[model samples]
Target: MTSLWQHARRPATRDDDSWSVAGNVYYGTGRPIDGMERPFSPEFEAKVRHAYKSNGPVFALMTVRQMLFSEARFQFRQMRNGRPGELFGTADLALLETPWPGGTTGNLLSRMIQFADLEGSAYVTNYNPGRLKMLRPDWVTIITGSEEEPSLASEAIDSELLGYMYDPPTGSEPWFLLPEQVAHFAPIPDPEFQFRGMSWITPVIREIVGDTAATRHKLKFFENGATPQVVVSLDPSVTPEKVKKFQALMDSDHRGVDTAYKTLYLGGGADVTVVGKDLHQLDFKATQGAGETRLAAAAGVPSVVVGFSEGLAGSSLNAGNYSSSRRRLADGTMRPLWREAAGSLAQIVNVPAGADLWYDDRDIAWLREDQHDAAEIQGLQSRTIRTLVDAGYEPETVVAAVAAEDYSLLKHSGLYSVQLQKPGTGSGAPSPTPPTTDPEVP
Candidate 1:
C-alpha cells in the first residue's frame, strides 16, 4: 500500500494542480482544490477519534447508529401503477447481502452509516470482477471531485459529478473512477453541494467537548485524592520559606490518591485551615449529569435509554414516558435515517422499476409494541370484513376493499340473502289481519 503522500505526487487529470502544496499539507492524494477533503487531515481524524473515545454523547450517537443499521432490514419491491407493486428479488439482493467479498450486508451498512454520521458523508466504489458486485468505502481524503454541474442552478447535481479520485490507504498509485462506478450516500445533504452530507455531530460538538472536559476534571480530581482543601496558618514566627517547604511536603505526602487521608505532621504552631470546597460544593454531579443529558438529547436518545443516571430515578422512569421516548427514538430519530440510507442504496442496487428499497422493522424486538398495535388493528379490519359480508355484500369484495383501501371494490351485487327479506315486499305471513276483521264483524 502506498502512502497518501506518495499518491498525491502521481499524475493528475484536468487542472488538478492543487497538490503543489507540501505533502503534509495534503490530506490524501487525488483531491481537488474545492474538494470537501481540503480541510481534512490525519490530525482531524485523530481529533474526531479522541472525542469519540472521551465523550459520552458520541458513544450514545454511535449506539443509535449501530441500532439503526443493524435492526432495520432492507428489502426490494417492484413498482406498478406508480405504487409498490410486489416483492421481488434481483441481483441487488446478492450484491447487498455480500457487499464486499468478506462482509455481510449488516456490516457494510453499519460501517457506511457510522462513517456518514461522523464524517458528514460516505463514499463507496463498486468494483465488478465478473459481475456488478463488490463495494468498498473510501475515506473522505481518498476521494475528491469538483462540482462542475449543480443539480439545481443553485445546487450541484449528481449528473454533474465528473469523476471520483481514489487514493488507496496502502499508498497505491492513485486512480480515477467514473461517476457511474461509484455510489455516494449523504443523509443530511448540503443544499449547496451534491457530494457531501451535513454531519449530525457538528451541532453538538461543543456539548461533547464540555463532557470530555468534565470527565478529565473528575479524573484529575479523584487522582489527586477525593478532597479539595487549602491549609493556612497565622504563625508569625514561621518564615515564608518554611511555609513554602511545608506546602511542598504536604503535596508530596498527602495530595495523591495513595496518600489521601494520611495524617499531616505540623510543628512550630502551624495551623491547617481547610479553604477549598469539595466536589459536591462545586456542583460536580449536577454539571456532569446535565452534560450527559444534553448530549443524549442531541443524539435523540433519552438519558434513561443510554444509562445516564440523570432523570432515570424520576419522571423519565415512568412507564408511559419511557415507552414514548423509546418510540420517539425509533420513529423520530432512527426510522428516517433508515429510510434515507435505503434510498441511497437503491441507487447502487438495481431496484426493479417501480419498486423501492424498504426496511423491515417488524422483527426488531425494540419495536414489538408497534407489532402489538398492528395486531389489534388487524383484528379491527377482520371485524369490518365480517360485518360488511353479513350485510349482503360479497365477501370477496368486502375483503378486497378493506385490504386494498380501494372503495371501487365496494360495488356490490344488488341481491339479498334468503335470511334477509327482499326490499319493497311485505313479510310472508299473508294476512293475519283477515282473522281480526272477521271477529269484529261478528
Candidate 2:
C-alpha cells in the first residue's frame, strides 16, 4: 500500500535515472469515484464524443478501408455512420441503463465491485460465469468437470459459453483462452443431464427455443442424469464442417472480434447476430492508457470503446509497424498527466472493452482480465469523460482529464501517444462500426 511518493529511492534502475519514478509511474490503483453516480452531464459527452469521432474515426477509416473497403470512400461511410444524432442526442450518454443486478445496492459501479468479490474478478454482466453455474448446469458440469485452470466452464447449445469454454470439438478458433484461476475443479459434471442441477438452466433453454434438442440437451442431460442407462445424448454443438465455415467468415469478415464473445454473437459489423452456447468468462481490461500512441494510432475513443478485439498475433500488419518513439521530455520527466495517472490506477472510469490496456479505479479489475468486456469499459469511459469536462476542462485537456478520472490511464502506451498525437507505426489500424457495447449494456 506504500506509494511511490512515500518511498525514498535507491536512485537507479538499469541505465535510467527514473529512480524517483519507480512505482510512482505504475497506473493501477484502487480509488473511489467522488460523484460518478450523479446524473449525466451533456457537455461531457459532446467533447469526448467529438474527440472520439474525430481521432478514432480517422484511424478506423484508415484500417477498415484497406481491410474492408477502398479508402476515400470508406472514410465517407464512416462519417455517415458516425452521425452522433443516430447513436445519441446532443446530451451525454443515455441515463445509464445498468443491467438488472447492477442497478441495485448503491448502483452498478458498486455492484460491479461486489460481483467481482463474490465471483473473484470483475466481469461485465449478471451472466458472470461464476453466477451462471447455478443457472446453467450444463455449464456448471462442463466447468466443474475440469481441473485444468482457474478460469473454466462448460455448456452445450449455449453460444455464450461456446465463446470461452472448451470441449471435444473446440476446433481452430480456440474456445479456451483464459486460465488465471485455479482451474479444473474436482468432479466434472456429465456434460449431458447436467442442466437439471442448475435451476435456471431449464427455463433459459426453453425460452430461447422450445423443447428442441438444445432444450432436450438441457432436459435429458439434467433431468435424466440420475438415471444411469437413460442419459442425454451428446454431440458437438458446432459440427466440423460448420466450424470450418464459421472460422472462415470469422477470420475474413469478423477479424478482431473478441472470440469469446464472437462465439456467442457469431458475426460482424452492424449485421452481426448472436446465438448458440452460453459460456463467456469476463475479464474487465478496458483502457489503453489515457490516449497514448497505441490508443491514438488505433483511433480508440478516449471513453469506453465498445468493439471486439481478436487475440494478439504477429500479423503481417503488426509485424511491420514497430517504432522507436519515446516521450521522455527534455528534463527526463514524463507528461504531468502521465505522472499523475501512474499514481492512481484503481479509480479510472468508463474503461473501454478490447483495449490493449485500460485504466481502472480498482486494482482488482486487473485480476479479472480473462472475461472482461466492452460494457465495463464503455461504462467507465463514458462516465469518466463526463466527469472530467464537467469539472471545467477544455477539449485540449482530454489527456489530463482522463488522467484525473483514473491515474491508471497512464499505464497504457497510449498515455504517451495522446500526448504525442501520432499513432505509432506498428499498432494495428482502426475498426469499423468499432466493435461496440459490451455484453452487459446491450
Candidate 3:
C-alpha cells in the first residue's frame, strides 16, 4: 500500500491535465493585479495590522470569524449515484478533527480563513505528507516553472521542495514544498492569475485606513495636554523661563485623564480663554459611525450583524430589516466562503469520487428563524394533506401531493377515478337503490 506520506510527497505529474509548471518559475511581485492597488508587501501587511487598532475592522473580522467557526459541523460522506449519501467515517475525519497533532480543526480553519482574509492567500503544507503545517503568507513565495502551464521545481534544494519556498522568520534558510503538499485557500481569486487569490481587505483597505486614522485622532484628542479649548494667555513681560514654568504647571494641573477636569488658577495677569470646538462639536461619533459602516460593508458583513454601536440605526434596529440583513450576510458572504474553504480542504483530504465536503448550518442560531418558517410551512402542508384525504383522496396521494409538491401522485391512485361531488357534500341525500341482477341471466 502506498503510504499517505508518499502519496502527498510524490511530485505532481507533468501532463496536459496536470497543473505543473514546465520551467523554473520565479515569484512575480506576489501581488494581486487589481488596478491601482498596492501589493501584499510588508508595508501593506503592516497597514492591515494597524487596521486592527480601529474598532470597525476588528469587529467585522471578529464577526466573520466567529460566525464561520461557530455553528459549523463537518463530516465525511459517502457518494452514491453522484450524490452525497450519508456521513461516512474516513481517515479525513481524524485529520480534520485534529488538523495538526496539537491543534483542533476549528482553530486550524480559523487561522486559514483569517490569513486568507488578510493576506489574500493561505498556504498550509502537509508535513510528513498529510499532517498540516500552516506557512506564513509573508515568508512564502510561489516559484513557477518555464512553461506557462507551470511545473514543479525538480532541482534539489537544502530543504524539501513540495512547491513553495518557505523562509522562516527566525533567519532560517528558505525551503521548498510541493503543490499537492499544501492546501491553498483564497476567498476572492483574481480571474487572470493562478498563484494568488484576492483578499477581502483589498476593496476595504481604504475604509479601514480611514477608520484607523479617525480612531487615532479621537485617541489623540483625549490624550493631548489640552482639551477642545482652554487657551492660557500669559503676560508679555514674563520671561521665556516663566512661560516654560507656567506651561509645565498647567500640564501638571490639568493634563490627561487623572487631572483632566481639575481647575487651574493663573497668576501674573494670565487669562484662560475658552476656544472653538469640543469633542462633541467635532462629532467623532458620526464620522466614526460612517467609517464603521463602510468597513463592514466592504467586509460583506452587515453593521447590525457585527453589533457595531453605530449600526443601531433605524433600519438595522427594525426587526424585518435586521432579519433580512442576517440572511443576506449568510447567503451572500459566508456561504460562498464556506464552500470555497470546503473545496480546498477536499483537495488535502482524501475525498472519494462523487463525494464532496459540505457545511451544515442547521444549528446556527442566526438562521434559526428560517427553521421556524419552514416548520410553519410544514404545518400548512399537514393541514392540506388532511383536507385532501378527508375529501376522498388516497392518503398516499394526499401526502405526495401536498408534502412532496407533486400533484402527479394524486392521479396515480389505482381507482383512476374522479370525484364529481362538490365540496361540503357530506350531508347530501343518496339516490334510490337499483335492482340486482345475476351474471348467469346475461
Candidate 4:
C-alpha cells in the first residue's frame, strides 16, 4: 500500500523533492509492486516468490512491521505533519498489502488473515475518532450511538449497504464499553440494521482473504470413513477435478474412529484415550451381567461411562438401553423403571421411578422360587447392600437373575406362533436342540 508520505532519496535539484525509503522497509523494499489496492497477479506472485526464495525470513519480518504500522495508521499520522492526523515513528504507514509468502502464489495470505483479524481488533482498541468517517464514501454504512456517533445513522442496522450496532449510551464515550462490540470487536464496525443485518455481514473482508488463500494452494479436510480432500478454491463453483489432489494429500496419519466419534459427540475437546489391560493376569469370574454394568460404572484412572448422565451438558442422549431398548423417554408413559421396581410389592414400584434396582429376569424368578416372603423382598428393597443379611442367593446368581432378559428366547423359540399352555419349563415340553449359531441369524 502507498504511504501517505513521500521523500526524495537523491540530492534534490532545487524543484525535485523526493526520497527513497531506506533500510529494507526489512531488506530495502523487497519488491516494488504496482501497489496494494489492485489484487494479486501472476507477475506479482512471481515477484513474491523471488523475494521469499532469496530472503523470506527478512521479507517476513519487514512485512510484519509494515502490517502493524499500516494497521496502526502510524505513517498516516506522521504525514499529517501537525495538520489533522500527525505523529512520528519508523512505523508510518496508512495502508499495506500483505507481504508474506503464500505457498503457491508466493504471497503470505495466511499471514494476511491473521493481520486482518489483529488490525480490526487493534483499531477498535485505540478509540479513533476519524475511523467512522474514513470508510470509502461510495460505500453506504450505518453506525449507531445515541449522541456520540454523529457520523452514524439512527437504526441498529441500515438497508442500503453497511450497518453497525452499539448500546444505547449512558454517555457518549461508553460505546467502547458495549459488550457486543467488545466480544466481536469488528473492524470498521459491520454494516448493520432494519433487522436484515446479522452476524454474517462480517465476511465482507473475506473476498481479499479467500482469493489470497486460493491462489497460494488448497485447503484440505480429512474425515473418517470419508475422503481426505483438498480444493483449489473454496468457491463452491470451482470444478471438483481441480480439488481432486486432496485425495492424495490425505494420509492415514493414525487418526481413528474414536477421533471421529469424539469430533461428533463431544465436539473436540482433548483427543480420545485408550486403556489396555492384560487379560492373562485378570481372573475370570462367572459374574452375571458384569459386562453390561460397564455402562453404569464411572471409576478408574480413565473413566468412561455410557448411558449414565441424564442430560449431558447441553444436549440429549438417553436413547437406548438393554435388549428391549425401551423408549428413550419412558417417564412419559408410567414406565419410570425405578418407580415400577419400588412399587411392585406395594403397588408403586420404586425401582423404575428412582433408579434403585434395574430388573433382571432371573433375579425376579429366584426371589419368587426361594424367598417369596414379603420381609425378604422389602428388606432387600429398603436396606443398602451392607445393611441387608445373607439372602441365600450368590452375588453372581442374583446379578444374573436381575440383569437377564427373555427377548432372545422369545424371538425364535416359537413362543410367538404356537399356542402356549404356559411359558418356559412349565409347558412340560421336551427341550429341542439349540441352533448351532445365533438364533437371530441374518
Number of colliding residue pairs in each model: 12, 67, 15, 50
lDDT of 3 by residue, 30-130 (tens): 22211111132453355345554334556566557655654565676555445455565566666777777787777777777777766677887766654
Residue 68 lDDT, candidate 4, scale 0-100: 25
Question: Which regions of candidate 4 fall more than 4 Å away from where they truly are?
Answer: 1-201, 204-442
Clashes of 3: 15
Candidate 3 at residue 130, lDDT?
A: 47
Ranked candidates, highest TM-score first:
1, 3, 4, 2
TM-score of 2: 0.15
How do the residues 1-442 of candidate 2 rate in per-residue lDDT, one tens digit apiece?
A: 1221111111111221111111122111111111001111121222123322333322342232122111000000011222211111211111123224334212433322222111112222122332211111111111222222212222222312111122222344312322232122111122222311111111121121221223234444333221122111224564678667765654553343232223324333213332333212211121222222233233212112222232222341242221111111101211221222211211222222222111222222222332355567767877866654544445445454353443332322232223333544323535335466677874
| Local lDDT at 395 for model 3 | 88
Write candidate 4's Cα lDDT for 1-442 as tens digits.
Answer: 0120111111111212211121212111111111101111222222243332333222333343233222211111211112222122231111111111222111222232222232221111112321111111111112233332222323323312122222222343212222222212222322322211121112322222232333232211123322232222234554567445333342233233333322322222223333322222222121211321221221110011123222232233333322112222222211232232212211111112212222222222212333445568657644532221133333343332332321121122222222424444433467667669877888
lDDT of 4: 0.24
Over 4 Å off, model 1: 1-39, 42-44, 85-91, 129-138, 141-159, 168-171, 191-194, 231-245, 387-442
Best by TM-score: 1
lDDT of 1 by residue, 251-366 (tens): 78877678887777877687877777777888877887887777777666777777787958778888898898888888887888788877777666667766788776777888
lDDT of each: 0.63, 0.25, 0.63, 0.24
